[model samples]
Target: MRARLDAESRAAGFVSTGVCRPDAVPDIAAHLSTFVDAGRHGQMAWMAERMAWRGDPAALWPEARSVVMLAHSYAPQHDPLSDLDRREQGAISVYAQGRDYHDVVKKALKRVARWMVAEAGCEVKVFVDTAPVMEKPLAQAAGLGWQGKHTNLLSRKFGNWVFLGAIFTTLELEVDAPEAEHCGSCRKCLDICPTDAFPAPFQLDARRCISYLTIEHRGPVDADLRPALGNRIYGCDDCLAVCPWNKFAVEASDMRYHGPHRAPDLADLAQLDDAGFRARFSGSPIKRIGRDRMVRNVCYAIGNSGAAHLKPVVQDLCEDDDATVADAARWAVERL
Candidate 1:
């Protein structure tokens, strides 16, 4: 059954798979409590909500005896760091450059789960970073990969770029051996951080993280962090790109996730109104940030660009209806 499960999952586009008991990570509850108590999650109150289910997968669904953790590859063909040097263009994270991974990965997870139901007669539920599931620790516990010093999954075979999804099942599947951390004094992911988001070897302060600042954060970012943002208008990927294990990453078979949004011109992005923003990113994950936040981020990027020629582009937005957008525009003009 396990071998057949692997074959079906691979056929459904999963790059890797592992099974583990729901309580595989006994320390997860404590680890989560510590992070939340410290407020490192910043504005993400959802992380604080449903603490019990987030802390313990077993408690989430007591009938589930095993968790089938899966990894769907989205590795970039080109080095994402190279996009940073395109100062006049916005550097979207490699993950966001393509279609939304949530939609893609969840669809694939459902397919795998459906097959398991038919073949093994097990009841299952699927989650793709949806709900309160903390997938990275569970992935490590299922032998998918270890949570590296950067606090993100780092797979030896697929690197740090795989999207994680979970399958909760009632079957008593044999569990895989948990993977151990292999960071080994490597500081590449740590040293390359533009915002110094990591306070320790295996911890992240999301408040100072650029990805959090650009995406999850609402309103004006700390003035101090704006310059470091450079042209990364959406999510940031510095830590993931710098991981040593990325050398082994295989290219994603799904072309929808590779090169659609690479480095769009900052000037072009700065002109988007609410309707334009919706239309442009209609099917993409970038749409979630909305026009106001996206334009605000673009203003910051333009300010860091030092491309004085683009001043007129943001100058038109100096009195945007959204106060945050207007403030960021004024800030950009001053910087230029």
Candidate 2:
């Protein structure tokens, strides 16, 4: 039954999996404290709560006997660097360009979890990013991939483009051995960060991370960092894009992950109203940020676009009811 699930995941394009023993839950808890104590998670205050449960999978769901970690590759089809020079266009991270990964990955995980339950007659629970599960650490311990210096997991087969998810079951499936660090002396992902988001190897400061600012941050972005954002209106991909190991990566298997909307125009995004934004980003992760935060992002792009014609767009945004959008729009207007 485990072999069948492995085959199914392999056929679906995931290259890694591992079953971590329930005892290893303590190791995950200990590592998580190091991250939280160091203040690397930024304003994600929830990480500080329920420390005991989040660190150990056994505590999260005492019924679980094994964890089946899964990774899906969403590597970009074309060179991401090509879009860097197109200042007037928005460069969304490849993962967020199409359907929300949580929806795609969760549906697939349910199938695998069901297969396990049928074979063993045991309970199962699946988790993606939404849960407090330390997926990267668990995946690393389970041998899905080594957590690279940028603190994101990197697979030998998929490089830095793999999206991680997990399924915990009461069934005791065969566990795979953990993988060893393969990063060696490479520091490209660290050196390429525009905001220097990484505080040290394998640790990230979310406040300086464009992905956090654009997606997780609720209000006005730091005025100082707006110019550094460049034209990346969505999640920033500089760290993932700069990884040298990505040369071995393959295009995504899911067709929903590809198409023209993969890269949208900055000017067009700036013009999206609440209704338009809702219709355009429906079923995509971008929709979760809502039109206001997205417009706040587009305003930053307009500032970096260097197109005087976009000045009107910024001016309009300055009058927006949301203080966050209006604040960003004023900053953008000044820059343009």
Which model scores highest in lDDT? 1
Q: What is the C-alpha lDDT of each candidate?
A: 0.92, 0.82
Model 1 CA deviation exceeding 4 Å by range:
none
* lDDT assessment of candidate 1: 0.92
Question: What TM-score does prediction 2 earn?
Answer: 0.95
Best by TM-score: 1
Q: How far is candidate 2 from the true structure (C-alpha RMSD, Å)?
A: 1.7
What is the number of backbone collisions in each predicted candidate, taken in the order shown?
Answer: 0, 0
**Considering summed lDDT, which 10 consecutive residues are worst modelled in model 2?**
253-262
lDDT over C-alpha atoms for residue 130 of model 2 = 88
Worst ten-residue run, lDDT, model 1? 251-260
| CA error at residue 218 for candidate 2, angstroms | 1.5
